[model samples]
Target: MSANSKVVDINKNREELITFTEEEVETIKRTVASDANTDELKMFLHVAKSYGLDPFNKEIFFWKVKGKPTIMTSRDGYLKIADRHPQYDGLVSDVVRKNDSFKRKSDGIEHEYGTERGDIVGAYALVYRKDRSYPVYVFAPFEEYRADTKVWYKYPSAMILKVAESMALKRSFSVSGLVSREEMDVQQLEEDKESPTKRFKKQKEKEDYIDVKDNAQDDSLSQREKEIKRIVGKSPKLKNDLLNYLEHAKKENDIGEEEKMSINKLDDQQFTQLKSILQTFKRLA
Candidate 1:
């Protein structure tokens, strides 16, 4: 059978699988894989199709690093692939804490934690296979994989657990080459332009796209600065209020490094939402 036939045969049961038509291929190139060349696009499509991943649904997508395309998926995507494996029996995972009870033995793993689990130290995942006597256990430490992003800042324990689960799934299913976005750094995620939250927000539109702008500190105003200035046009009092309020929030630890880094490039809606949130914090102060 031809490569196309093989791809079709692999995912024949999945009625929602993407059909790579001439126009559809053009759309994929223009949207998600814009930076890719003909060969890169072909390779991306082949891998995505082979794994029954639909890029439109955000199961798998391309990441451009230094003008080169790299395939990346989410933790859920890893689970999807693992579930498809004939021997994949089940998965078990949890976050470990500094004060929590955790142990690893030759045959099994043990962990216990309470609601007040001090701080997330690490996470563990166990992938059960039908053919294996013991499940595959992988422990991922927080310090090793944590990124200084808003998501990690807000959900450290959950994020670390995802990293562990992704690692375990990859190893258990023999999945290779592609990396999960949860394992990537802030710079890599930023380079992707479209974040998971932004994708969801724009999912309804036919030509949906996130307006990603540079957050670099230049002498001139950045896009975010410009937007803020426009919002505060001719309102010197409001400008001072914002600056003073932000300074106070920083001093109170209401805002951290992650928020500061992201504040540089937030779209208008996000900026407005931040202002509303800061107003709430101001009341508590």
Candidate 2:
């Protein structure tokens, strides 16, 4: 999102016509440059488009995970996508407790929410169509677990039902381009604003592979690192000249610490900036 741009929350049942504009996204590019990478921003856009959500209208959202953007939608967004398809008589949902399922009959309008009963897991949905013999079954589980707190950060009941609902909708109507909002980031949307410490606290809490020193034992790479590799993989011409570009960037930025540094070794911010710059070069090439 841009400094001037804002996202508005809407009802779960409401339908919206979203159109992403160049200006709005360009602003995102500028804003992300300071903290996030171009690929992260680009992935947000791609996921939004592929899933048919619009950030401009707040149908979906961008979350800052470890100072990088991750795509996610609010409970409202999850619900909105769920109700898009037509329902059949076979439509049924249930509340899950431990390993047992409590069958709940639906009136086709009212949904039965899950419970906090013994080891309350999540809700289940069975979406059916006119032609299909078997109803499309979907399991929507809670994704708000916080390892640090050893608890689920999001409301259990809120997530349980919506997870089931969204799952049913996506599996039943996936061709219409629906994406699951589960496991996506929603910290910013949940709050109007948070303190910087609180904002980055989530990042610190999450265990990510970061290589700051020239010699490190951890060879595992983060999602951002993988994204850089994918971006580089797109352009053979640019990939061949990556070393030269890296050298120029280091010289221009006044960095002479290490003559040799792999692209994966660059920190998140540096990698993001480099990817953006290389993308421009890729386009030209």
Candidate 3:
């Protein structure tokens, strides 16, 4: 992705490093204010620009996770580099529904896993370079996360193919030291981004807090979600009010296209706040 702003040109060759978003600019300034590593931040910015990546994308740079500043290319980063590379040829990548071709681990036997669609088992990719004699091949298998088919629910085929393609590209161009940090699982990266602070914790409290301390000991997230839905379903007026409340609570930029449950996604503190608003609407109804 192209940068949103221009960066300070630090080259004798007169090349601008890259531009940063307002948030990144803040991070850089904040790092300096807090006596943190600003030099390392600049170094990462340069590396990101060299790769033609936008640090503001959170793939290339984010201050929330680690202390040191360095470039971390996202999945987008890998795709972008592949798109711009002069030596690049077409990529051959696809989802593998079964182990039809490859040998199996259990019995050391190769049999048809069959035509019935099941969980996507693996991904295969080959990066062909015009200059290289041999194409780089990569076969990446999917791993289960917390017993949930996490990333599979989002971009199972596409993401898996990307992983394989990136793996092949990075390995093939080992001499160039090319890297895409997205080779790190995108699902894991998302979960890591939310750490130490839940992304939905930003809901504004428009009403007094409701006391849900009694059910606070319940460990089941499903239980809380069900209870909240039940309460909201009691009246149409309540439901409308709940939706409107959430809509009003978020600023224009704060809302994602499908971020309707910003309130529902909130933590206990905000949940209680939302419950109070629901109760008010119920009383009025």
Candidate 4:
């Protein structure tokens, strides 16, 4: 198939593919010139080959790992090294407990956060285009490990290709510009203003008021009427009816026949629909 045909097929499967912008490419070139190391250069070659770009593309830039190297030979070696280094011992213990699937070394170096073990020490690099210039980050892990001897071998080019393909899949959809440090600080400040407990308490208070209102409208015979009124004021339906009934009952000096009948009818309805409401008031009393 033609190159265009292959590109079409790839695009069909991965719809988010984006080419680098010119400015991004130039920045990458500068970074590569200033800081590219052997490992980063290797990763770049791996990424380029997987993307069907020339492995020696002039525009590509690579970033190298920095800081003190932590080396591990075997599980015992890792532990030994960690025990000697206070800062790294905790990390080693955490990895041993959490990463049961991996073979660890005793004495070499502590693994940094975001590092994954393949067969050897895993490392990361960024790939940028010379033409357009967006960064595509790549992670390469050791391909083979000897548990007893504490040796790791470089992952093969084919394995590296797979890793590169995975990185491409991720980069294709990723946003280029990231939130600045200042923006992140502002976001954290806003979040700190409202804690989870405070938000929950506010929601619960609103719900309690609603419950009190609903109960008042449905219960007239409730002995805890005073308490309910205090909770959510008098219900509109019950307020007028209750006032009129009280007034009439007081004027008659004794229960009138019509009033007695109306009271009885209301009692019967309450026994059926508002039984639970009455029970709640009784409990409160």
Candidate 5:
């Protein structure tokens, strides 16, 4: 066959191998890639199919920051990719506390801690490959990855360990085009008022990977509504700011009266829309 014919055949074969049904594709677009445009959705599906990821199972997800698409995978998703590699062996990881006896020897890391290990300071992950003599090791400091988010606040050690493990797995397996949840700092993204593409470009300059927001869409509709309401409820300043912004937008005829309803009275879809409007308002402010 000619070179062009061979390329066409490979593309056809790949398309035939995709297992996501049309319904699933619609669901993915509506929920996971809700903010994605057509070109963004195409790129997302290409990466998903290339990695044999199941969006239905959330092995990978789509997020957008300021209109720029960001693809994210879990640590388990990275491990899943590694497991499919023939050279994969196993993995070991741990978080180091302030009192832990941690040392970096020639072969691998030595970490020891007791019940009273105090506060977590850092974490390390080691990925063993059957073809390699030594394991791929990565260390992540707590301060580097920790954020002022609910997840980080509640599960600091687990989150940092995930960061270390994701780094190690990507290094060992050459995984590309995916960022784990542990690497993202949504608060930082919000606080940085740069253009969406510019903010991501700056992050890429530093980390060479896309950044994702929180795992908010993973929750159910009712759960998301409650979470959104809870977030607005806790921040008196945020609530006041949102109300004022909505009132201003109303005066400009940008939004309607329904958008000004109390957060508790809004339904699921309205809550999501309200949250999105609030984000846009914050960005503009």
Candidate 6:
């Protein structure tokens, strides 16, 4: 049968699956508010299994690719959670400071004292990209801490509840553009003239394609032509005989026997002597 006909039959055998319901989406939002462990995030798994939709998957992918949310942590970490709501930010900040290591850095001329170490607290921030999605905004004590050894701390559930109350009280503070350093660098490059690295990469890729195309053209040969070329020193009659034998072996599904015989013939002492002579001819050619 034709390739297209086989594809249609295969497609017909496959089944479609439904993802999550509206109620399930609401349940997910509620579950995210608590300190849910990796296993506790079963709702997300179910959604992924059903429809292959994952909200946190993109965040994780971005984190893996860009190496943590640096910019978000830098900006959000300084925001006084207590000022927005009575003692809310202070409570979370206090917990983070106590649990983790913090350092002070000079804001150029002025020394701004901020928590530089401890468990980081993350909240859903407004998506910075044109795509309207929520990205997690991490608030930590400091941005200079080593990612490998530094222990990150999270705010207490009670503090999160307080912040949620303040969020409900005043809906003025909207989550805005919070992008990673890598993402910002890419954006800056797009705004400027073509970057040198990008131009070099494009030129290298074009050259590679040209080389591949030329090599492919040089390698292109029909099966019969290949057989004739491989058996160059042999008589035309012998080459034709070998080709015919190969065709018959393929048709009868007896290729293994022919392959063994072909290997044995090539390995013969006489064949090796002939090959040495052919190599001398190749050097002269």
Candidate 4 lDDT, tens digit per residue, 1-285?
223332212123333222333443344334332233444433443343333332123222232112211110112222232233333212211222123243333332343444443333333333333333344444444322111110112323333333333333234334122221112223334544677799568545434322233344545634444443543233332332233333332333454433332233333323222333322222211
Pick the TM-score winner: 5
Cα RMSD, model 5: 10.6
Name the TM-score of candidate 5: 0.65
Error of 3 at 70 (Å): 5.3
lDDT of 2 at 159: 52
lDDT of each: 0.63, 0.49, 0.50, 0.31, 0.64, 0.29
By TM-score, the better pick of 3 and 5 is 5
> Better model by TM-score, 1 or 5?
5
Ranked by lDDT from best down, the candidates are: 5, 1, 3, 2, 4, 6
Q: Pick by lDDT: which candidate is best?
A: 5
Cα deviation of 217, candidate 6, in Å: 19
lDDT per residue as tens, model 1, 12-128: 544433456565676677666654687788778877776667876767766554445678787888889888778999999988888888889876787777777787788899999
Instruction: Assess every candidate by TM-score.
Output: 0.61, 0.42, 0.48, 0.15, 0.65, 0.15
Candidate 3, residue 275: the lDDT equals 69
Ranking of all candidate structures by their TM-score, best first: 5, 1, 3, 2, 4, 6
Q: For residues 1-285, could you state the per-residue lDDT of candidate 5 as single tens digits? A: 123322212133454324455555676666667657877877787777767777766577776544457787878888888887889999999989988899987578888777887888888999999999999989898876675544567678887888899899999988788887665553453465567798567644422221111223535435544555555543333443445433333433444433443334444554565575444322211
Please report the TM-score between candidate 1 and the true structure: 0.61
lDDT (Cα) of model 4: 0.31
lDDT of 3 at 209: 29
Candidate 3 lands at a TM-score of 0.48
Task: Name the 10 consecutive residues with the lowest summed lDDT in model 6.
Answer: 59-68
